[model samples]
Every structure is written in C-alpha cells, then in structure tokens.
Target chain A: MARLVTLVESGGPGVREVASALAPYAGHAQVIGLTGSPGVGKSTTTTALVAAYRREGKKVGVLAIDPSSPFSGGAILGDRIRMQEHATDPGVYIRSMSSRGHLGGLSATTPQAVRVLDGVGCDVILVETVGVGQAEVDIASLADTTLVLLAPGMGDGIQAVKAGILEIADVFVINKADRDGADHTLRDIRSMMALVTREPNEWRQPIVKTVAHKTEGLEELLEAIGKHHSWLAEHGELQRRRTARASAEITAIALGLLRARLDVTDELASAVAAGEMDPYAAADRLLG
Target chain B: MARLVTLVESGGPGVREVASALAPYAGHAQVIGLTGSPGVGKSTTTTALVAAYRREGKKVGVLAIDPSSPFSGGAILGDRIRMQEHATDPGVYIRSMSSRGHLGGLSATTPQAVRVLDGVGCDVILVETVGVGQAEVDIASLADTTLVLLAPGMGDGIQAVKAGILEIADVFVINKADRDGADHTLRDIRSMMALVTREPNEWRQPIVKTVAHKTEGLEELLEAIGKHHSWLAEHGELQRRRTARASAEITAIALGLLRARLDVTDELASAVAAGEMDPYAAADRLLG
Candidate 1:
C-alpha cells in the first residue's frame, strides 16, 4: 500500500498501469475527511477516531494530506509520532502526502491514494488534511463525510461563515470542549447556521464536542458519523458524491496530462516576449 | 483601455482577437514590481513613484494585483483612493485586478491586462501586488525590475530569510524609515543577503531607505530601480525574464484550453466512482 501511495505521489511513468491493477477491488471503504486550523486537535481527534473504528473490528486506512509551504515546518513529524501507536497493527495503514510542488495540488494524487487503500482491504478510510485554507474545501468535496473542527475562541460562527468554511461542513466537531467559552462557541455556530435557509429534507450538521486528549465524547462522535453515513446511503447521496469526486479527480488528471504535453517553444516565447504575438494567439498557434 | 482590461478579466469570447491586436505593442513597457507585507507603506511608496515618474513626463500604467480573499476587505478600496490623485492625469492608466475567482489565477488575465496597457502606449508599467504569499513571487517573474519592501520590526532578517522572499528581490526598499529600529531592519536584511553567495558579476540588491509619506528617498529609490533596469538590459537578463514570463503565460492559457476541452462523460465518471476504472486510466480514456 505504501509503495502504491509513493508511486501515485511521484506521478511518474507507469502510474496508470499500477492504478489499473488495483482498480478492481476499490469502492468498498468509507472515506471520512477531517480538517481544521492548526491547534484544533485534528491529529488527536483523528488518532482517537482510528482507535474507535479499530475497536469495532474494522480495518482502517489513513491519508494525511499536508499543504504547508516549503518554508514553513510541517505537522507530519508530530503526526507520525502520535500514529506510532498503530504502526504495529497490520490491519491499519497510514500514509502522509505533501502537496507542495504538484501543479494539480491534492486532486492529482490524493484520490488515487484513497483508491489504493480502498482496493487493499480497508473497511474505513480517514482522510485528515493538515493545515487550513483550500485544503479543507478540497477534502470536503473528495470525502463521503467531511468533519470541520473548531475550538473555543478560534473564531465566532460569523467569521467561519464569512470564510466560507461552514458551507463545506457535513459535520462540525468542536474539539477542546473542556476549554473556556465552549458554550459561547456552540451558540455562535448555532446562530450562524440559523441564518442560512435550508429545505426540510436537508441534513443538519450535528455539532459534537470532544476533549480528544481524554478520549471524551468519542462514542458520540462515532455515532454522529454513523448516522451521517446512513443518511448518505438512504438518500442515494453516496453514489452522487462519489461520482462527483470521481469526475473532479478525472478532470484534474486530464489537466495534468495536458500540462505535461503543452509544447511551448522558445521561438514562440520570443514572439510573445518581443510583443509580436500575444499569449492567447501563441496558445492557439501552439495547438495549431 | 478600461473596456479592453474588462474583457480580458472576463476571459470570455473575443479574447483571442483582442489579444492578437495588442500583442505587437507589449514588449515596450518597462515593467516594475513592488511588493511587501501589509502595513509596510506599499501604497504610499507606489503613489510617490507615480508622482515622481509623472514629473519626468513619462506615461505610466499601474496594474495592482489584489490577492486578498473576499472575506477580508482588500487594500484595493484604499488603493483606489490613493490612486485618485492620478485618476485625472491623462498620462496615467491605472487598473485594479482581483485574483479571487479566476481558475487560471493571475496568470490567466494579468499578463493580458499588462499587454493592453503596454499596447496603449504606457512608458513605465508598475505592477504592485497587494498582500503577500505567492502573489509576490508571481509579480517578480512578470516584471523587469522587482522591488521587495520591508519596514522596521516587522520580522527580523531571519524570518524574511526563512520566508524565501529575499531570492525575489532585485532591489529592497525599507519603507517607514522614520520609525525606530530602521537601522536594525536594514542591518538584518543586509546580513541575510550577505549570507547568500552570489556570482562575481551578479547584481547585488541595493537596500534603500524611504519615508514614503513625506516623499523622502523617492529619488534614491527611483535611481536604484534605474540601475537594476540598466543591469537587466546590459546582461541580456531582461529578455530572458520577459520570455520566461511569456512561456508561463502561454502554458497557462494552453492548460486552460485543454481543461475546457477535456471529455469526461457521465459513464466514465460512474466507472471511476465505482472503482471499476482508476482515475489515471479514466483520464487516459477521456483523452484517447
């Protein structure tokens, strides 16, 4: 599985052949995405959830997508230390992918990585995105269920809504609930969600509180996840979401292939540089 | 000019014809880029540069690339007010571009906007990027001369070094030079630059002090920019940079073209979603 993940990440030659070999046995695992800002206990919650899912006699796969810039220190080292607890378990497989240099970003390799774990024998797959910004939205679109984490005083619900993070939440997990202002945070979130109009049949994202350090509220979080999964299956939303994610993944791969084959010659570049030809015309000529 | 810029920004039909028409005039403008962290007096310095350039009877164009998210009130509103002083000047063409929703980002439209200004007879084009991150690097590649701005006590030279911003500087301007720790900031930047080994004939970035509000050091800043421009021309690096920028621009347009034409059918999406075909294989099939 690690070898397969590495091959996909490298995006080198023979990647398609390997992916084709593994394609037959996938589509069984449930993909759950967890994401939040740093210091939101995402790693801890992911660890806790892994253990909970393991206790259910289920095999699990973990894909931790890191989006930190090359300059900033990434959280993967700390994650590896925490995940060492499950490293000896043959049934649990965990992988970390850095999306720093890839032009297609997460879409190019992440879905392929997920498909690898799904193909192998994992029953539940947890995709935890490290860091903030666009990675959250990407993970949300790619997963069957997305859990957006928040802590007290992180930001009020108004700020989250304005940031457009709330729109990606299938479920909201308020980690560090034992900290001060937890109630205030809950009220803020509730009030913000109230402002958005939804139909009667829409799924209301349940807010679950957890002190991941103490493993408190672990069972309730799992139950909420299970309920959401049930709702997805019942409404045929599962098929729709999986297909949508697949479409995006395929498009990104196609775009990457196109980028690689773009024939930009220095003569053409010189024309554009010399103001004898515009970029739009140069592109047309390149294709021509 | 305003209509042309708007059409390019929209990235709609008639773009190719518009671009082909303007392509012949783009190579004339001496493109200059100025960037810095927020609160570093970038706008004041830019305004000062414009006024000083106008005093020389030079026609100037300003393309302020705003990378701020929608949730945060961008510096554009403030920039427009500062630029109003130049609004009535027939010799100046000033436009603000927001890189918020465009899938191709600044690459898709900024070059076209610059081309329009260049085609319409602007002598000196100032490309000032509002805010930080990748936008700074983007503007650096697009300009003939790049000026990275800093202020006292924002971050020690070490943080700047760590941020990798120093590599993009052709000239450094320490704005707010009247503030305390001005000398310290200069020393920090100097020390950081000194650590990097440069070729004997390579251009050494000169650090200039500026109290932009009072218009102090404006002449020295302009002189340093002129020196760098001369160096770029004499060393054949100006053409290199322009061609490199053009190549990236052309490639972005090509990729945008390929993405638009990718044939991802619903049947193909379903197969990949069901794991009967991997995303990589699906992409190949779509292209094939």
Candidate 2:
C-alpha cells in the first residue's frame, strides 16, 4: 500500500501502471470528503467518524491533506494525537500528506491515492482537507459525499458561503455544538440553504450538529453520510460524479504532462519580456 | 479602461489584441503585490499606499482580487469605503474582481489588467489579495515587489511561513504597529528571517511597521518599495522576473486553450470510470 501511494505521488511511468492495475477494483468504496476551516475540530470529528464506521465492522482508510508545513509542528501533532486511537486497529489505515510547495499537488495526487485505497478493499475512505482554498473545493469533485463542517464563533457561515462552500456541501456538520451560539450557526446555514434554489427531486442537505471531541452526534453524522450515499446510488448521481471526477483527473494529468513536454525556451521568454514577441504568438510557437 | 478590463475578463479574441497593444508599454510600471490574511487591513494599507504614491505625483492603479462572493457584501463594502478617497482622482484607478468560482482566475486575468494600466502610463500598480491560498502566491510571480502584511494577534507568522509567503515576501510589514504585541510580531518575523540563508550581496528583506489606519509608516513603506525596485533594476533581476512571469502567463494561456480543444468524450470518461481505460492512456488519447 505504501509503495502504491509512493508511485502515485511520484507521478512517474509507474503511476499509469499502478492505476491501470487498480482500475478494475476501484469504485467499491464510498469516498467521503470532510472540509472545514482550521480550529473547527476537523481532526477530532474525523477521528470520531472513523470510530463510528469501525463500530459497524467496516474497513476504513483516511487521507489527511495538510497544507501546513512540517515546521509548524503543533497542528500536525494534534492531528496525530487525535487519530492515535485507531493506530492499533488493523481495519483502519491512515495517512497524512503535506502539499510540498506545489500549488495543485494535492488535487493531482489525491484521486490516485483514493483509487489505491478503494482497490485495497476499504469499505469507506474519508478524505479530509483544511477548508481554505481551491484545493478544498477540488475535494468536493472527488467525493460521493461531501460534509462541510462549521462551528459557532468560527466566523465561518458567511465566509463559507462567500467561498462557495455551501454549494458543495451534501451534509453540513455544525461541530462543537455545545458551544454558545451553535444554534445561531445552524440557523445561519439553513437560511443560507434556503437562498439556494434546488429542484424538488434534488437531495436537500441535512445539518448535523456534533461535539466531536466528546464524540457526540457521530451516529447522526454517519447516518447523514449514509443517507447521502444512498441518495446518490438511487438517483444515479454516483456514476455521474465519478465520471466527472475521472474526467478532471485525466485532464489534470494530461496538462501536467503537456507542460513537461513543452520546451519553454529562455529565448522565447526573453523575446516576450523584451516586447519583441507577443505572448499569444509565443504560445502558438510553444504549442507548435 | 473598463472596456479593456471587460475584454480581458471575457477571454475572447479581443484579449490578444489588447495584450499585444499593451505589451510594448508594459514593464515601466512598478507592480507591487500586497498580500496578507483577512482583517490584517490589506485594504487599509493599500489605500494608504495609493495616497502615498499619489503624493509622489505618480499615477497608480489598484486591482483588488476578492475571492469571496458578492453575497458576502460587507468585506467588499469595507474595501470600497477605505479606497473611497481615491474615487474621484483621475490619476488613480481601482477595481475589485471576484473569483467567480474559477480557480486561478485572478492569475489568468490580472496580468492583462496590469498591462492595460501600464499602457495607460501608470507609474505604479498595486495588486492586493487576501493572502490565503495558491492564488496569492501566484501574485508574487507577477509583481516586481511583494509586501506581506501581518498584525500583532493575527496568528499569521507561522501560517504565512507554512503558506510559503515568507519566501515570496520582499518586504514584510507589521501592520497595526500601535497594537499590543506588535513588537513581538516584528521580533517573530525577524527571527524567522534569520533562518533563511542568503548570499552576502543579496538584497535583504526589510521589516516595516505601519499603523495604516492612521496613515503612519506610509513613507517608509513606499521607500522600502522604491529600494526593492532599485535593487531589482541594479541586479538585473527585473528582466529575469518579467521573463519568468511572461513565460508562466504564456504557458497558462496555451494550456487553457489546449484544455478547451481536447475533446472529452463521455465514452472515454465512462471507460476510465469503469476501469477499462487508464487515465494516462485516456489523456494521451484525448491529446491525440
């Protein structure tokens, strides 16, 4: 499993071979994406959810995408401490990935990693990301079920809406539910949801409240996720979402390869910099 | 000016015309990028900088990229209110752009807009972004000078370092200098900078303190920017940076066009989804 993940991350010729070999066994596992702002207890919630899934005798895999650097050691350490409960469970597999200074590396490597986990016979895969940037939104495209977590006093509702997080959330988890103004956060989300027009037959997102550190509301959160999965299967949205994900993955890989193949000459760059060549014309030359 | 911005935003045939027409006149303006986390008073600093530049009798243009949605109207309103001082000045042009759900859209259109401003003979161009994600880092590539702002209690130093903001920042500003712990923030950044190795003759990054709301430290910030600009010029780094920027811009445009041209068939998507076609092979097929 570690070797397969290394292959995917390397983005070498081995990736194609590994992906092809795993392709047949993929799509069996349910992929769930959990995203929320920092300090919202995403790690705690993720730990709780993993346990809840384990209680049902399901094998689970986790991929935590950490955007922070190793130098900022506290947050990553906290994640490890929260997730250590599952360390001895053979049914659970967990991995953390750092961005490694590449802007879109998380989006580029995550799908292949998920495919490897799926092929390895995980009953469910939870992909967790800090809800900050485009990378978090990319997780929505990859997941069959996406949970957007929020908490009172996180100043997240309007900010989340502005970031377009509301559109991607299938289940809105208001974590830290015991906090003051948790109800206000819940109401804020519901009213925001009301602003979004959806067809009558479309799935209405459910709000699940959780005090994740206390392991509260884990069952309902799991149930909401299960319900969303069932809805996707019933409406054929599962196939549609997977197809779109595949399309995006293929395009990203193709573009990366093309960029590598395209020899961007210093001469061309200098000419453009000197204003002797237009960028469009230079682009044409590069394409040729 | 508005029409040119619209044309660039449209990403139509007219973009090439606009870009080519402006290409020759570009490189004269000192493009400065100001980035920091939200509530760090990026807008306040930008307003102060604009006023300082205007006092220098330099024509200035501001491109404020708001990744948030228009529905979250308060933040945008705050930007407008802060920048209202320059609303009637013909020498100053300020425009706010939202991400509109397009990843890297700011990177895509910002250069063209800057070119338009440069063509009109602006002496300086200020690009302000909420220093959150990859997009803000992309601003570094496009700017001649990059200023990173931090507040006393913003918890930004470590986060900024993790985001790779420290590497890109040419000038570090500890804003809200009158606030408690401002000196600690300044000391923290200085200590962090101490860790990065640089050549003896390399331009050392300067830490500037500013209470932007009071318009204090404006002169020193402007002077630091001027010093960086001069250093880039003297060291021949200016041409090198622009060449890289143009190269990236051209490549991004070329790849965007290629993606548009690549015909993604539902059959290919389904085959990949079904595990019959490997994504790399599918990418090659789409390319062919």
Candidate 3:
C-alpha cells in the first residue's frame, strides 16, 4: 500500500517501483461492477455500499466513471460531488474519471485507476460506470462480481431485455424501489432471467430492491455481495477472474500504446470523414 | 457510385479503391452531421430534412447509427423504423447501423455503408447519430457539417452547455420548436455561444428553431446548412476540414486494427465481463 501510494501520487520513478512492490496484493481485493441506466440512483446506491462496507470496518475505494463534458475536459463531476460527504473519511477513498472520449463504457484511465486502488490495499473496489447502453457491458469482465441496476417504470421488460444489460448481470438490483410498479419490474426481471440458462458457477440472479437515496435494504445488498464472493472463492473462480482482469489491464495498456504509434494519415481521415472508409476497413488496411 | 456499390456489396476490394472512385464529387455534396441527447427527436429532425431535400430534387442518403442490443445482436432499430416511411422512394436511401459493440461511435461497417450510399450517387448524406455523448461525437466527425440539437426544458443552458454535445456544433437546432420554452432555449444557446469563439473558418453557429413533426422552420434550417456550406467554401476551408477529418479517420482506424490484432486472447473477454477494461484500451494495445 505504501509503495503504491508513492507510485500513484508520483508519475515518474515511483510508478515502476510501486508496480514491483504492490504486485502481490493485486489479486486480493474484491472488485465489483455496478451499472444501469442513468438517473437510476447509481451514485446513491454506491454511496450506501461504501458506507456499509466502512461500517463493517473495511477500507473501501469507490471509483465512479462519469460521462465527460467535452468542453470541460473533466468528469461531469456530478457523481463525485454527490459523494462529497465521505471526502473527510480516512478509510474511504473516492476517485472519479471521465470516459476520456473512449467509446466503451469504462473510462480510458479506469483499469489503471482500479489497479492503483487495489495496490493501495482497499478491501473492496466499487467500479461504477456512467450509465451506458447495452454495448458498454464490457465492464463486467473487469470485476469479480457484476451488478446490473434497473428501476421500475423504465419502459417494458422487453425494452430492458433488448437493452442487453440483462444478459451480463450476475445480480440485478431494482433501485428506486419505492416507486410504483416495483413488483412488476421485479417480476419482469425474474421472467427475463429465467429465459437464460445459467452455468454451474453462476447463481440465479438475486434481485434486491432499494430506495437508494435512503440506503434502505443495503444490508441485504451487502449480504448478496457476500454470497457472490463466497460462491466465487469456494469454486476458485475468484482468483481466475482476478488474474484474467490483470491480464485485461495489461491488454488495454498495450493496445493504447499501439494505437498511439499507428499514426494514421490525413488521407485516411478524409476517407473516413467522407464516409468512404469504415473503421474496420481502415483498421484492416493499416494493420494488415 | 458503381465502385462503392461493388465495395460494399462484394467486399472483394479494399477501402482505397472506393475512396479513389468517390474522390471526383467530393466538393459537390455537403455532408451534415445531426446529433443531440437521446429522445430529443434527432430522428424527427433528420427525417424532416431528408424529406425536404428529396422534395427539392436532391437525392439523399441517411446513415443512422444506433447501438445494438447486446443480447439479441439486433438493434432496438428505432432509427430505421422511424425513417422507413420513405423506404420506397428511389431518391432516398436509408440504412441503419447498430454500434455493434464498437466504442468509437461507429459500427465497424459504417464507413463501408456510407460509401455504398455515396456510390449510389446521393446528392447529400445526412448522418444521424444516437446522441452527442463522446462516442456519438466521435462518429459525427465523419460528417462535413455537424449540428448539435437540443430540446427546450431539458435543463438550464448551463446543464446543456456542459454536456459533451455542445462543443462540436457547427450549428445548433432547438428541435420541438412548438414546445413552450423553445425561445428560451434559443436565447440560452445564443448566450452560451457568445461566450466561446471558434476558429477563423468555423461558422458562428446560428441557433434555429424547428418543430420537426410539423415541418416548421425547416426552410430556415436548410438555409442555415447552406450558409455554413457556403462559408466553408468561400474561405477555402472546406477542403482543409475534409482533409483533417480524413486524417483523423485513418488514425482512429489504424488504432482500432492494432488493438484487434494484439488482444484476441480470452483476457479481454474475461476482464470485459468484470467491467475492468474498456474496448478502446484493447484497441489501443492492438495499435501498439
């Protein structure tokens, strides 16, 4: 943790030393992914979880990925601001990142940020993405556990299923539970869940309802998270998931570096801009 | 047009061949980019414009990009359905693309699709994006003129300006012009535009009001597009913008290819499930 502090705080010499020193603890912490549509009280639910974990005497790191403000070049900053009540807590560390113009759900800096938090010895790392559409569910691969949040009255379950978020969910939480039609939403989610065949390692997704703003029913949420953790640990999937996540981190870093080196030309950009070249074709020609 | 049709339909030739054939009419057709927040009637405005153009004896191609449903590998397909009313018209060509899990705001096949439409000899291409968040804006760079659309009563101008969409507006349209606060939205947009100075060749971004469903103020909208187009040509900046855009497309394409080549392992899939790595980093690593 000490090694990573300097490494994270200082970018030059400290990074390598910290990377070498904190290499062992990389797989110890629990990484959880939380996602749903925007305005579903993600920030609120995350805050509740952080508080609950802290109450249990665990050090927690909350990483919130906010949509970037193109003009500001920073996070929309709403999620961070909403969680400011924890700003003074020593056991709670919070960081917010913008998508950084990357098209996928997670921010470009997110995996690195997660590694930094893990290296700092946080017992749990809560990674929250800006509510992305179905395609952004890629965040599921990064965590030991994945939670897909949904709300009542958010159109139909068919729309929800078609959204693709339902496919990646290991656990579903119907947040804003106090709203009318919560039961209908819950029933819809269960029916949708029934449509998919689960693997032996995967459990029936537990749907917990919560008015995230009030933090009600968070204990059940934590208990469910604990159950998921136990399931993974006993089956030995936790370590596998972690190692795979580390490998992904390396993969993203490596790809980012390679992309910087390709040095695409003006003619190619013109062709793409003019709609003459698709990204795949451009990629195929540049790399092939 | 024949070359593009062959490139898209046959896929035997590369993008360079299609680009080469389409180079002749680069200056004749003005490409427009339309974007806004989701549910803001971007489709309605785009449909209105396409209809207007076709009525004026201009052949139009509408390239609409929406995210695919990850579960079904199909799109909600709203854009295509919305514009299908004109499907039978020989002067109108409309194609819908799902983001198809790519984060760069375009599906891998978008460029090829555009070429196919262009090759069909459409006088103008109207590209409508899912929304003007980061990925959508990245996709919008594919167009010659980009329009940022906002609806009234969305929020204060502060909320609207801080969004990623406002930065790329070549022109701003307050769609749903019949709404109560449309004038206020226009005033706010003008006030916000006053605070920022654009590049020498860039237009001063006129704010137009349009009731897309009613077809109100579309003439003015067309006039605004025409004015921006003329402004770029008069200053000889049209070619410069087109060149820069093509260069960016090439750069983005090269990076995407490199990412794909390098990270074909199960590592990305696993971490992506965990929510730890974004698709772009994977793409970036491939670029390296």
Candidate 4:
C-alpha cells in the first residue's frame, strides 16, 4: 500500500518501515498460527488453507518455521521441498525459517519475518511452528488468533501436560479427523478447554475436526478462525492483545541480542576453564 | 563430601561448594542427559538407570525438567510424578524444575539446580529435559554426555530432520526395544551416525536398545554411559566438553534470565492486545 515492497527489497533496512507500512491493514488480515505434534498433517492443513483462502481471492502468506541445524545454523529446510506446488502462484508466498537452535521456541527472526509477509500485502499469514509440544506455543503470543492442532490418539494426560500450548489456543483443531480417536481428541480438547476460563471479554474456545489432507473441513476451520478474530475485534480485545505482543517484541529482541553478547564473554570463558562457574552463576553475573 | 547437603538446601548458594565437592569425582561421575519425544519413556529410562546405578552402590541424582504452568509458574511436574517409586529411596535424589518460560532450553534455575545436586555428593546427575524434540537439545551442553533417545516408529526421515539433536548425541538410545519397529530405529541411528565422521579422538555415537520401564537391557545402557565417560577422559574429550559446557552454562544462563525478563514485560501485554506481535516476535525482539 505504501510502495513498501520496493523499500523492503532494497538490501537491508529497518523493520519499522515494514511494520508501519503494514500497520494499516494489520487489523484486516487474519493471522492464524497452527501448531501441533510432528506427523499431525500440519503441512497438509496449511496447504488446504492456502487453497481455500486463494479460492476466495484472498492473498495468503505461509511462514513455515522448521527446525534448525545446530552445526550449520540453518534450517533443515525440508518443508519447502515438499510444498513446491504453490511456488509459482503469485497469490501465495511461502517462506521457511529455521527455529535457529532456539530450544524453547521459534527463532528471533520470526516476527520480522512475519512482518515481511505482511508488508508484501498478504491478507492472511499462516505461521506454523515446528512440532515441539507445549514449548511451540510461542506462536500464540505473536498470532492475532492461535490454533492448536492435534491428532487423534495423542493420549489423555499428554495433552494436559502441554500447559505451554493449552493456555494460548483460541481454537483447537482436531486434525486428521478421519483417523481413529479423532472424536476422543476433540472431546479431550473440549474437556481441557472447559477447565480453562476465558477472560471476561474473550470468545469461547472452539474445537473443529478436519481431515486436512483432503480439505474435508477447511470451511469450518476458516469459519472458526474468522469467528475468533471478529470476537476479539468486537470486544476490542484484538487491539489490546496485539499491543501487548508488540511491547513483548521489544523485550524479546533486547534480551536475545544481549544474551548472544554475554554468551561470548571473557569472564565466562575463564570461569568455565577454571571450573569456578556454572551456567546458573554466569546468568546471575551476566544479568548483573 | 564437604557437607554438600547444606548447599542443596540453599539452592543457588550451594553451586560453588557442590562443584568443589564433586570435583574429586568429577572425572568419575558421568552426567548423562536423556532426551527424546514424549511417550519415549525418558523417565522410565532414567528410572532404570538410577536402579542400575544404585545396585552398583553408586548414588544418582535426577533433575527432571518439566513444562511449567504459565499461570502458576510451577511445573505440572509430571516426570517426577511418574517417577514416584524412586521418591522414597535414600540413595536417589530427584528434583524437578519448570521451564517457567525459559526458551533457551532449561529454566533459569535449572543449571543452579543441577549444580546443587552436583555438590550433594551424588556420583551421577541425570538431567531429563522436556523432550518435545530438538529445541530441548540444550541439555547436551549441560551434561558431560548426552543421549538423544528416540522411539521405533517416528516415521522415516523424522530423525534426519532432527539435525539439532543428532549432532549432540554422544550416545543414542532406541527405547521401547520390544516395540515392533525397534530394529528399524536402531538401524536408522546407526546409519545416521555413519554419515558423520567421528572426531579424531572422540568416541563414536553408540545406539543401545532398552525397555526402560521393565528394567530390561539397562546394564548395557549403563555400560554405554560408563564407556562414554571413560572415552572422554581417555581422549581428554571429557575435560574439553566440560570446559565448553561450562562456558555455555554461563551464556545460556544470561540468555535464560533475559528470556525470563521478556516473558513478563508490559510490551508482551501490549503485543497480545494489538495483535501485532506473537510470542515468536516477543522472544525474537527480546533476543534482538
């Protein structure tokens, strides 16, 4: 909208341009996060969503977060290899990023990466994090609407242990619906959701069952996302959530960089070498 | 043991004395990290190891890192709960820490927690990380030896995508040995191990088979850990690894604290409100 595409393509620039350029439609686009255990057909679900959105003439962006190779500091970069069918479509943009050895969550570049897609004029950004159970819930903090995808037969308490993810879902998608125990997963999620009380103004968490690979329930999934987004907007909760996420953005960036700096300090080196310090001590000293 | 029990009581304060007290057997105690996907019986394997170690008259300490509840900032603490049988034993000590939203792998207090145990005169400190997958590989840098546990049927190539975990494994344990596809998993690991050229003086990654809960094949597992220790010492790799991990401990500590800080920022609140930021952005901005 602001000739932002040209500015962003100019080598390297501040992210503010990207953020501000994309700010106008920030509320218009439906940004949904999809996360679940590995082998849960997350990719298939994403593909169907892309097709569904495009069928409606809506532009979409898919930011797939893959696991990074610790040795090379690059993403395993396999998801793209398989999802090349949409590579030539102008209405869709797919970008892959390595979680970059980030143990507890997604990479530091994820937000700016999402902003890049936003600046590119996507009406929807489907951010997918790697399958790491609860820790992968980091996506919920950034997404306007968060969806936790689960397959059938993931076991009872296993879902409960994912406190990291359970607390954040606006919608729970029981994907691979054709599989056995899909209903059980749905019921389990509903039971879990029932235990979690939404904020006074927040919408009730919805559970939808879908066979993502077949596009069996893409319409219902889309509807659920739409319902959640609109609910937030009507209650003005959308604006409140996004602002809090932005401030979190500043703190996350500040800490990530500072941590990288402290990771390479001389004192830390001497301490480890002398056997006089541990990570816990180094943390205190580094923060101090 | 330098009255190391007092240090464990004070938590953080006991790290120095514990490290010093453990220094005498630092070379002898083999700190092995066990991690893998959920349902892989990491706790069962840890339990089996403790039993085996105790039978040999060796004291073992287990530091089980569980996913913490964001609301209460406390662990659901499932690992230890499942490990109740060992709770009443005098020779075995178990401590649990919640991720408490620390994204660099373990919680801010984890390293200190590990140190507290190290000082308590335990011969071995077994750290069980919340194994959602590769993101939890930070344990490799914490333990002197690391075992990346995998199950039989995670689908082909799933492990290949796990570059982070694979690179860090001093040993690989394919647990649930009696499962139908156990052989395939064993072969997969061996083949993957073959892909990398072993370091000149370091030990090759060994894949061991075990059914942990049944206490089956644990002797071989302990043998592997012991052999790995001997290999490290014989090759000077143990000291080298410890030195490296020590430095990582400091850096990860700094990052852990920073992560903790960002987790609670007003900015996060704003971003969540505005829908402009997600946790990935929050975490990234915190890092940046």
Point out where model 2 deviates above 4 Å: A68-78, A99-106, A156-163, B68-78, B100-105, B156-163
C-alpha displacement of A179 in model 2, angstroms? 1.9
TM-score of structure candidate 2: 0.93
lDDT of 1 by residue, B1-288 (tens): 888988887788898888888887778889999888656888788899999999999999998766533223232365767778999999988877765432323566687788888888899999887434445656777889989888988755322333456778899999999999999988888888888998999999999999998999999999999999999999999999989999988987887787778868889999988878888888889999
Ordered by TM-score, highest first, the candidates read: 2, 3, 4, 1
Among the numbered candidates, top lDDT falls to 2
Candidate 4 overall lDDT versus native: 0.67
Q: Write the per-residue lDDT of candidate 3 for residues B58-172, one digit (tens) a residue.
A: 9998877665344333356666677788878888877655555443355344555555565557789888875634556565566778888888887552224355455677788
Question: TM per model?
Answer: 0.78, 0.93, 0.85, 0.82
Docking class of 1: acceptable
* TM-score, structure 3 vs. true: 0.85
Better of 3 and 4 by TM-score: 3
Positional deviation of A258 in candidate 1, in angstroms? 2.3
In model 4 chain A, which range of ten residues has the least summed lDDT? A2-11
User: Which CAPRI category fits model 3?
Assistant: acceptable
lDDT of 1 by residue, A1-288 (tens): 888888877788788888888878878999999987656888889999889999999999988776533223232455666788998998899876655432423566688888888888899999987434345556877899999888998744322333455677888889999999999888878987998899998899999999998999888899999999999999999999989889988988887887778879999999998878888888988878
Q: Lowest summed-lDDT stretch of 10 residues in model 3 chain A?
A: A2-11
Residue clash pairs of candidate 2: none
- Fraction of the true interface contacts (Cα pairs closer than 8 Å across chains) found in each model: 0.58, 0.41, 0.33, 0.37
Candidate 4 residues lying further than 4 Å off, grouped into runs, are A1-28, A68-78, A101-104, A131-135, A157-160, A197-200, A263-288, B1-29, B67-78, B133-135, B157-160, B255-288
The lDDT values for all models are 0.79, 0.79, 0.67, 0.67
**Measured with DockQ on alpha carbons, how good is candidate 1?**
0.37
